[model samples]
Target: MEFFKTDKIFDFMGKRLPFLGLSSILVIASIIILFTKGLNFGIDFAGGTIVQVKYEQVAPISQIRETLKSTKYANSSITKFGSDEEVVIRITGSSSDLTNDISDEMHKILDSTGKFEIRRVDMVGPKVGGELREKGLMALGLSLIVMLAYVSYRFEWRFAVASILGLAHDVTIALGAIALFNVEVNLDILAAILTLLGYSINDTIIVFDRIRENIQTSKEDELKELINQSVSKTLSRTTLTSLTTLFVVLTLYFFGGEIINGFSFTLLVGIIVGTYSSIFIAATLLVQLKFSIGDFRAKEAEKLKSKREKEKLRAMYEQGTV
Candidate 1:
């Protein structure tokens, strides 16, 4: 089960600068794309009409698109949603009871080709979409804040700070992939992002916990060497976990159908970035932040000292000596 021997000592921290630089450039590029290209927000946030139609027979997507081209709905985005017989049409704006108009138009156009049933037509107003977008952003912001607090409490603030930076790196990379590919962001994508944050933090916490344990137990003098050794020691666990997760995500991407494609795609990009951040971004930032064994040991000593003082005080009170 071990891909790397327990005694393995790869110098991951030795080549951290290059990785950090690479991550920085990626983050910057993602920001540029965010401003320049922007994300393709789906009907969930972009305020549009979603008309889901189910056909009795096999309805070719190209034929559907071609039929719509002759009508006002020609500019609509059509995709084979769940199955070969089910398709979802998304048209941005025009949501003031426009579903009927679209449904009638589609029925007239599609009646000749095949008898299809309009399963449902959902309309999202601009106001609702704006609210959802704001809520989504707020959720992401709150998640980061909560993760920072939790990591800070679990480890040191330095480790927590490093964890946040690492999560940001993963998120930026995922978002970058979506923007680069022009994938439509929907509720599923938002869920995937939240999942990514949790997953990435879990990886970061595992490594940070190892770093903390190593600092506490080992008398290693060189901080860089200590980090490198800690990372090397956990390399197998990280690799195995990430690969297992990646395999599932790849399967989901290939076979989960279009409905969850955004979700799978986000996870696919996220797993790689999260794994890299745990190894390079988080650990390297620790080195850059100059985390020393003494710092952690000093905190440990303070905790132990405080515990001993409380114990002594309790004993004195029992003996009526206080």
Candidate 2:
């Protein structure tokens, strides 16, 4: 359903500099945050024993840490899972044997806290975690390369480059948000990031596709105006799509429990950031890259010129005029 009248064209590109500047600042800040603070890597990547416990009463995280300090499990990371009664503990720099023996040791340690339940325990070796981390990074890198190849093949190298830039912008900010907020970097978060790549690129492609179609069909000579027009026309669709996605993601974030909180959070940020970059970053980039509809027109002209020349040569041959 179209929410806008045909004449209503939002000047999305008019203020690209401010938005681009904002994006640049955010990207740089995110980079700094990533390097300085780093991510909260979970046991899935950092190699640790995860102990999820549900207490009969409110769990004392500080007391639990104090209790572990005397034991081999010192320096365990303890945090609330979902409620005051639920707690998650991570013990890193320990061997897998410790993970297997955690049940006995934890029970002995927390014996004073009566009537509690061990919800779960997970163990990952350092070597395995490192491999997973390496493979995950490889997957992300390969996805970008594949997308570059695909977009270049389908459209032009310029479009591929522009879309990749937009995607990079989305990813950088999303990861930065994750790091800044100290979100757990695990297989789930990695999955969410990969999902984000697809979600973001889909939006970028939509904007780029409209620009391509408009360039081919419209007689508009001004690239900026064409881009503005294209984005304006697709604005409603983009808004609706992003809103619907936000609703679902927001729901998952709020009510899906802590298990998928990081996943939904990534999507939530990705959808908004992706939408913005597609409309502003990607579209504005086309203008900066000197996207010209005249190129297509030139190609068409060349084809017509070649056809006319062929016709003239055929006529001369038919007339036996050499």
Candidate 3:
């Protein structure tokens, strides 16, 4: 099914300046927010104990908080896990002794409320958390480098640079949103960010590939006009894919439970930013990089010319026209 009609024409390049300006403002603001506020790291990145408890009956979150108030977990955070009958308790600064007996202690403290069961327990030490954090940063950096290399090999260096920058823009804005909203950044969320990087680059490659094809096939339009036509031509595919993915992510965000909340939320933001960058940010960068039609079309022209010459020689051989 088509999200947009085949004949639809949009002047994406016509509004390049406005879109680029808006993207710049957002990226700059995101940078500032990230620097000032910082992300709320979860147990996976910050040393902590996460105890999940499920009760037979609906339990008020406040009662759980009150129950923990008298115990060593008084500073812990209590929130409904997936339903009112379950709750997740996160204690950020659990001592070794406390972490050791956390499951028992949580059972003892929460069992008094009602019939409850310890669903799961996760304990991350400072050293382990530090190592994971370092590795996570390295993974993100390495992914960017790999993406740059791949895009450079697939397309021109200018397109590769633009695509990578667009991916950076999406990631930065996603992180900024996390920081601004004080959402907990966990291993799951970090995974989502990496996934976002892949998806964003994939979308960008689609547009760039289309532009390359257009440059090779048609020589009637100027650079900006060719780009505009290419974007317009591919608008349907881009819109349909992004919207379809958005629908799935929104469902996950709403019903995937609190454990995966950070993951889904990151994807939610990243997809929107990715879609925008694919159309405006990455494509616009091509125009700014002074992309020339001749540079790309010259080789295409030579190949086409050779193909025509071969076809003519075959025709002459068959018809005795040589």
Candidate 4:
């Protein structure tokens, strides 16, 4: 479904200065925030114990917290899982017996209230958490390097560079939001960020595809006008796709419970930023890179010339072998 008339055109290039300026401010602010505040690493990246317990009836989170105050898990966090009968407790401790101690203590006190079961327990040592953190960073780096190679091979250098920068912008803003709000960074959230990278590049590729088409099909040499036309053509499609994805993520954020909250929240931030970068940042970068129909034509002509030369060499080489 089209959100706007197909005939309507927007002047994205005309507002490039403002759009770019705003992005610069945001990126700078995000950098500052990241340096000052830092991420709130979860148990997956920070040593801790996580216990999942299921109660026969409603699990009173408040009472559980109050009761645990006198125990070693005084500062523990308690949250309802998928239902009121299920709860997850997260404790920041490096003790090997933490999981068993917590389970035994809960059983000793709350057993009188309702029959419950220990569903699962997770314990990560500080050293293990450090290794995971390093691996996570490596994973992100490898993904970006791979994307850079793919985009460079698929499109022109201009398109490749613009798309990569756009992805960086989207990620930086998303991370900044996480740091600003002190959102928990866990393995699940790392998955969300990786997913966000894929989602973001898909949009950039779509716009880049249109931009390529617009450049070749048009006779005009006005780069800004061509870019504006291309962005306008694809704006409706981009908005529609982002909105549809947002609907699912929003549902997860609101009702998916605490287990996947960080994951869903990361997606929530990434979606909005990704859409903006695809349309404004990535597209505008094309204009800044001074892409033109003449440049595209020259590149195509060069490719054809190179192909003919290769064919001539192959023909000579084959004949010589005989």
Predicted candidate 2 versus true structure: per-residue lDDT over 1-322, tens digit per residue: 7677667887877898998899999999999999999999988998878999999889987888888888888878899998899999888874644745778779999877666889899988898899999999999999999999999987778889899998899999999999989999999999999988998888888888888788778888888888889888888888888889999999999999998999999888989899889888988887778766788668757877999999999999999997
The TM-score of candidate 2 is: 0.91
Task: Point out the worst 10-residue segment of candidate 1 by lDDT.
Answer: 94-103
Q: Whole-model lDDT, candidate 4?
A: 0.87
TM-score of each: 0.91, 0.91, 0.87, 0.86
Could you tell me which residue pairs clash in candidate 3? Answer: none
In candidate 4, what are the lDDT values of residues 123-195, reduced to their tens digit? 8888889899999999999999999999889888888889889989999999999999988899998999999
Q: How do the residues 146-240 of candidate 3 rate in per-residue lDDT, one tens digit apiece?
A: 99999888778998889888988999899999999888888998899999999999888888998998877776558788888888888889999
Using TM-score as the measure, name the better of candidate 2 and candidate 4: 2
Residue 247 in model 2: lDDT: 100
Global lDDT of each candidate = 0.88, 0.87, 0.87, 0.87
Query: Considering summed lDDT, which 10 consecutive residues are worst modelled in model 2?
Result: 93-102
Q: Residue 232: error of model 2 in Å?
A: 0.8
**How many backbone clashes can be found in candidate 2?**
0
Where does candidate 2 stray beyond 4 Å?
Answer: 97-99, 300-322
